[model samples]
Target: MAQISNISKQLQLKCSGERFYELFKNKMDSITQMFPKKLLSYKIVEGNGFAHGSVVHWKYELRGTLEAKQKLHMDDTNKAITLEFIEGDLFKDFEMVAVKGEVSDGGSNGISSVKWSVEFVKANEGVAPPHNYLQFALESTKGIEAYLCNNN
Candidate 1:
């Protein structure tokens, strides 16, 4: 059987949950345009754009230039978005990779908390965890927050 594992991180966001949620949920395609270093370009290959069940083809710069076909699953109630990689370079070491992110109320001050979780199945027992992928998510969150702070 393949080895499955998980990793997660919680971050205090500098922006409101509603702002973050709106951008991520409604304007996902702009991510690559906003951060060209981490993301190159993305195209909605199926479904109604960022809606649940949609499939997106992403060209990104990770270890190098890589492309991935991912399915988007969004939970509006909890402000969570999940990206399941059905095909990509990730499959070289991972049988599967699912990344889930949630934005929520931080407290009365109206700050927000963003949580990122990654679940993966190793193609083989010798494969290492996707720590770099998680790191990319973390840095992206911070970059978005900074951009929002400066722009909004």
Candidate 2:
């Protein structure tokens, strides 16, 4: 068995924490429209919306249009969402990959922050953890934050 490692990144947003949480809980597919260059499309493969056990398929431009599937578990009261990677190139070197995002007030009124974290187990001792993938998550969050700020 491989060791499980975890990493997290925090970002401040101009948008409200409620708005940020709503995006993940209800409007995730809209992200493809907000960042077309990075995300192509997202479809609900099973279940409905952001409910637990819902599986989503994603097509995104990451080193040439990679595709992945994830199962979502959302906590509306806590403003948190978790995604477990089910299949994709990301799993090539990772035995399991899970990402979680939590939204909270960012020190002052009208400002918010999101903490994105990833936990993964490498496929083998020689396999390295996914740093670039985590960067992708951070950049995507920033892009969504900008989109929300500009649209609102």
Candidate 3:
């Protein structure tokens, strides 16, 4: 049986939680524009947008120009979003990988935070879990926070 693992990270930002939630929940495609250095492009491969079951294709540079497809689910009331990897290099080592983000106030004026969690089933016990992916999410959140702060 595949081994399941989970990891989570929280990031505090000097931006509004509602704005961050809106961007993450609705303007995901625009993220490439905000972080062109890290993200090459993104498009909704299926569905109308950030709706449930929507497939999003992301092309980006990490070690190299890599692409991944994710199935998206969002809960507006809870300010949460989840993306399940449907296809990608990650799948080689993970039978399933779902990344979830929850946004909340950061206990200060104009400050917000996001909790990023990853749940994954390793393809085999021999395969090590991908922790770098969590770093990527944190870094991306920082970039987005900076972009929003500067642009606003």
Q: By TM-score, how accurate is candidate 2?
A: 0.88
**In terms of TM-score, how similar is model 3 to the real structure?**
0.88
Candidate 3 per-residue lDDT over residues 1-152, each given as its tens digit: 66568999898878888888888777777776777877887888899986778998988787778789999989888899998889987777789999899998655555678999999998878876667778888988988898888878
Q: What tens-digit string does per-residue lDDT give for candidate 1 at 39-124?
A: 88888899988779999899999889999999999899999999999998889999899999999866677769899999999888
Residue 41 displacement (Å), model 1: 1.9
Q: Ten consecutive residues with minimal summed lDDT in candidate 1? A: 26-35
What's model 2's lDDT at 40?
83
Q: Which candidate should be chosen as best, given TM-score against the real structure?
A: 1
Q: What stretches of model 2 exceed 4 Å from their correct place?
A: 107-111
Q: Model 2, 1-152: lDDT tens per residue?
A: 56779989888877888888888777777866777888788888899775678998988887788889999989877788888999987877888999989899655566688988899998877877677678888998888888888888
Task: lDDT for model 3, please.
Answer: 0.84
Candidate 2 Cα lDDT to native: 0.84
CA lDDT scores, all candidates in order = 0.87, 0.84, 0.84
Q: By descending lDDT, how would the candidates be arranged?
A: 1, 3, 2
RMSD of each: 1.4, 2.0, 2.1
